[model samples]
Target: MGWVSRLSTVIRTQVNDWVGAVEDPEVRLDQAIADLQMELLQLRQSVAQAIATQKRTERQRGQHQTWAVEWYNRAHLALVKGEEALAREALSQRQSYLTLMAKMDDYLGQQRQVVEQLKGTMRTLEQQIAEARTRRDLFKARARSAEASQRLHTLMAEVGDRVTGGVFDSMEDRVLDLEAQAAALTELSQMQPTVSLTSQDSRETTASVEAELTVMKTRLGQG
Candidate 1:
């Protein structure tokens, strides 16, 4: 019996602790949602950064193309003027610009790929967040229902303990015994209560009765 009582106490305490923890599920779910939102925001920022980089690369490519054209034009003019050294220098500059333009084109292509990947990741995350929201609510509801069930089980345990000869049962028995004793005493008192009241005793009794009547009236009014 001692071991059984101790085990019951432990189980009740653990269930109470678990029910108390149920309130935190909502907080945990919110934190999860917040974390996902932060990730999405960071991903969006990365996408924006990639787009900015792509735009800068495109602008650089366009500038290089323009520079190459200008250099080619200068090279042609120098050749027409019979300036071979100047024509050669202009053609070399134009080749360098064409090389840079080609590299920039490749970089731009890679940047586009990165941007597309970011978009795909963002789409996946959005879908995941939506799914998580649904799951979060379901999880919270289940936690709440489980907590209520645990409380009901605890209450039943307490009632069962009272019914099965625990302290509460003893207390109930003591109350019934006292009630029976009081009934016996009352019957004895009623059998012998025929004494006549003297004038002074009657006056005191009247005063006491009046005071009790006033108190009862006041309580009734308040109620």
Candidate 2:
């Protein structure tokens, strides 16, 4: 049972590895790049929201400062009018605004640092994406070139097989047949005898002379 379990595990691992090997690298690379882009998009949105919050905080802090100044002016005017109690109350209001302003200043400093960090991260991601795109293009070109070479080799292999099985043999046989026909025609022409007008005239003259000799011999015979 333990051996069977180990075998099953090995088979499953091998199957998974085979599946992963068959998966296209280009598709996986594109998907990884897309995921990164999505992450960057989300990060940008986060940065935008953070910046909006930072701006809102800045406005609130500015408003607090304005209120504080206004209160201080009121306090001074009240003192001039000899309203001591009112002046103290106004001064207290100004102090409360000042405290809020101090807290806001601290928060603004922290927010600025955060925004700067986010911007820096966004820049880094952008640069990485650009580099990834360049590498992807290069890899895709190499893959296409490799595919073309493979196809060409496959075609050459098929052609070689055809040549061995039929095409080349048939062509060679046809060429040999044509060469044999040409040689036969040349032999036949060489074997044929050629007669000229001079040969015909000499043969006719010899035949006539033989006939005259035959007639003379017949006449010379004693009758």
Candidate 3:
């Protein structure tokens, strides 16, 4: 059971590591930012719609109020002309317009409030997007740093490589051997005479001729 649990844990860990490697932090951040931007767009649209509705309601309310006043004016004219029945009809029409105007005012208030809430929601989304942009840069830096660290780890992971082939030791020895060989070559070149080896026959012939000239001079002197 313990072994089974350990195997399961290992598999899970391996899967998680694979997932981590495949996941692109930048892509995720960009997607998240895009989603927020879309939400912000939707909220802005909602706010615009709410504002339009409120404005339309307000306009309707104003028109109703104007009609109510007109009806009251008609009632006044009826009273001046002594048409009592006509005056009652005018007042009744005025009351209906006033009732409708009141209802429109209520609707306008609710619509305005909805617009305010949508505006607030849009502001919040904008703020989140701003913060997300900052974090995206930060996370990108972190991802770069993490990749560098992983490469370093991969390069240094072979604990046995140094021992198996004396890799480091061999490298050092090879470098030293090269340096010694170079130094030996330098010394040999410095010790060599600056004479032309290509003219060995000429050098030997000149030396022999000089020796014969000296012998002739000695013989003449003796004679």
Among the numbered candidates, top TM-score falls to 2
What is the overall TM-score of model 3 with all chains considered together? Answer: 0.62
User: Which 10 residues in a row give candidate 2 its minimum summed lDDT?
Assistant: 1-10
**lDDT value, residue 30 of candidate 2:** 92
Q: Using TM-score, rank the candidates from best to worst.
A: 2, 3, 1
Total backbone collisions for each predicted model: 0, 0, 0
lDDT value for model 2: 0.83
> Each prediction's TM-score against the native?
0.57, 0.76, 0.62
Query: Could you tell me the TM-score of candidate 2?
Result: 0.76
Off by over 4 Å in 1: 1-16, 145-223
In candidate 2, what are the lDDT values of residues 1-223, reduced to their tens digit? 3444455456556645644553478788899899989989999998999999999999999899999999999999999999999999999999999999999999999999999999999999999999988999898887667556655555555555555566677899999999999999998787654446568789999999999988888899932
Error of 3 at 93 (Å): 1.0
Where does candidate 2 stray beyond 4 Å? 1-23, 163-166, 190-203, 206-223
Could you tell me the lDDT of residue 136 within candidate 1? 91
Top model number, lDDT: 1
Candidate 3's clash total is: 0
Candidate 1, residues 4-116, lDDT tens digits: the string is 45656877898878866866777888899999999999999999999998998899899999999999999999999999999999999999999999888888888899999
List the global CA lDDT of all models: 0.87, 0.83, 0.79
Which 10 consecutive residues of model 1 have the lowest summed lDDT? Answer: 191-200
Winner on TM-score between 1 and 2 is 2
